[model samples]
Target: MVSTSTTGVLVLLGAPLGNPEDASPRLRTELARADVIAAEDTRRLRRLLSELEVVPGAVITSYFEANEAGKTTALLERLHDGKRVAIITDGGMPSVSDPGFRLVKAAVDAGIPITCAPGASAVTTALALSGMPCDRFCFEGFAPRKDGERRRLFTELAEEKRTMVFFESPRRVTDTLRAMAAVFGDDRPAALCRELTKTHEEVRRGGLAALAEGAEADPPRGEITLVVSGWTGPAASEATPEAMAAAVAALEATGTDRKIAMKTVALRFGVSRRDVYEAVLKAD
Candidate 1:
């Protein structure tokens, strides 16, 4: 049994994305020594513990999205009592688009010490396998489910210079790719990483349009992560008024609303919407 501190520490455990061997030694030790274990899925946690061959003596409780808000206070009470509380998710680190954010924030407000056992993350794994520039990147947890919202998001990120990573459902991957192709341009380079670190893991590299087509032909299964190359177009400052107007006109020709087309062009070119509007007027 590990010694406990006077003030309990919140240990954020990183569950392996898929492979059990990827679990860190420190994570194993923490699992065995925790006073209480809060898991996103108790069944999954059981499978993991069985795989790791570690018998945890801690009191295990389910801490998932639905009950996270209600359970945080009770967990905080345990922490105040100096019990080592470990938070584990289905995969990857807790609180990264997961259920632990609320508890983490509550613990922070309560002045509890927090630490983590870092392990395999799909974000970095897919990013590494993507063959895109990794020096700079952003993780957009999951694309919006709604068509309009998702398109708007892609439009806003159209000019992002950093490589982008996104988690997407298998069913929506193809559609999401098509939406991305529409806003980020058909020729933009991208990679689709599916079932990462698992037996049937696969990575498909191509332009957004090609990816969409391939996915439509043969739907991918398991968890999906997308890595898209950032915009490499001329800087917004270098964009001439004529160029902005032409871009908006192109979108408008595709049946996009005039105002919305102007906004999309502005975002794609990294210019003010007003500038795109003025350019359109001058072109007319």
Candidate 2:
């Protein structure tokens, strides 16, 4: 379907996250004109085209994580044969916790020109809707499936000052929330974005501990994006003994035991629990 002789080019296409109208005219044209189209799921591509009412004119083939390595070579051969190839995923951009990295790298190494037709991304979409600071943020793809690894990862990022974005499955969403509350503190502000850009889209914003409890009470369904507020870092003046004692006192007032409150305060501030304990005792 490609009319031009221009070849040896790889195009990365960004599929709509949910809404069919989000598909761009450029994407439609490319889908109809590319020499060959590599898709994460050919059936999903067909469905998307059906919804968009734009049947692809090019040959469509699967290029998912399982077989990307093998297909990249074949795809590069097509490119070398003066064919235009476009790569698309079921949702959002490719290689962001998805397939296509291998092909992109191979294309680049082979001097095959690479370009992109950017579109909706759940990462940015959720970040925008999360009501959290977006100026500085990090997308942590997906959390570890193992509890220990996930918690260790959370512990490592506990002091990260940049707002964090994470993808989670509905099944483990509650567990992830609980782990987040444990590592980042129960009072940390967070948002659970579910089924983003879809009819059943929902965004629940609250303290991590409360969200954990709510997820426990009623498990969520659909794709999930968890956005948590970042540590703002210690104030320039640093927390004095008085400030540390006051923080523990505030937690105690909220029914947290005095000893537990002191430890919580220390973890939240990246300070010593012993120091917090001493501060609390002196205040008493």
Candidate 3:
């Protein structure tokens, strides 16, 4: 250990989200000087250090979600003993959606000096490429995995005017997007950013329904970021049954499955599923 900690310090370093080169100089310096590296995944951090080619003199320790409640006090004890500990998650900034929040809260309550290494984030990456406004946006992280909770999340954000960013897994992308389309709308402009900053990086921009259907047919692998456009107030025809049917048809026009379309129409217009289904059938 370099003993850079005559005064204890905790630095939350942002690991590279995808491309290894995304590591920042500040991150390198922090990792180099940290007496203890509290990382979510020790092996991933090791690979990152190898990629950066910076051999740290610090002791590496694991600090992920599973053991955070137990490790918070121990890590705080190290800090209290005047050790400089650096925390890093697998990717993106720690404490954002990762395991560093509890530790950060503990340190702050104890009057510990805490700082961060700003680097690549899927939130910002997807937002910039999403062709959506970023000047004022909110990162919702990952929505709940369960359908009911996820639906409530979408409902809460249904009226959010600021551009929204979300992290989703591969297998659940379609389901999540379907829920988003339901609460937000089939015509709500959105983008699906996959494998950002990697070899097979792709950005598919369209309505939520379009991306959901496409991704369902060909499920995207690796990380998925959904940058959905802000609420636009009922898509011009929210007042009539015929208009709702037309909107559903438009969503279907973009290759969204009928079931997904029904979900969207039913939720967005605050109508029953049976009503939306009958309307779509009448349209046919």
TM-score of each: 0.86, 0.83, 0.84
Each prediction's RMSD to truth = 4.1, 5.7, 5.3
lDDT per residue as tens, model 3, 1-284: 57554559888888888788777888888889999999999998899899888999999989998999999999999999999999999888889888999999999999889888788888888888999888889889898988767865776687688999988899899988887776677668999999889889999999988888998898999988889887655543464778778767755654556776677667567677888888878877
TM-score of 1: 0.86
Residue 260 in candidate 1, Cα distance off native in Å: 1.7
Candidate 3: what lDDT? 0.84
Instruction: Indicate which candidate wins on lDDT.
Output: 1
Q: Give the best candidate by TM-score.
A: 1
- Per-residue alpha-carbon lDDT of candidate 1 for residues 128-210, written as tens digits (9 for 90 to 100): 99999999999999999987788778878988999999999989999899888767766689999998888999999999989
Q: What residue runs in model 1 are displaced by over 4 Å at the alpha carbon?
A: 1-5, 234-256, 266-284
Question: Residue 271 deviation, candidate 1, in Å?
Answer: 10
CA lDDT, candidate 1, residue 53: 90
Model 2, 1-284: lDDT tens digits are 85565556788999998888999998898888898999999998999989878867788999999999999889989998988999999889988888899988888888778989999999999999999999999989899998767766776787788999999999998888877876666678999998888899999999998998999898889889999999876553445788788777655554446776666667667688898888888998
lDDT of candidates 1 onward, in order:
0.89, 0.85, 0.84
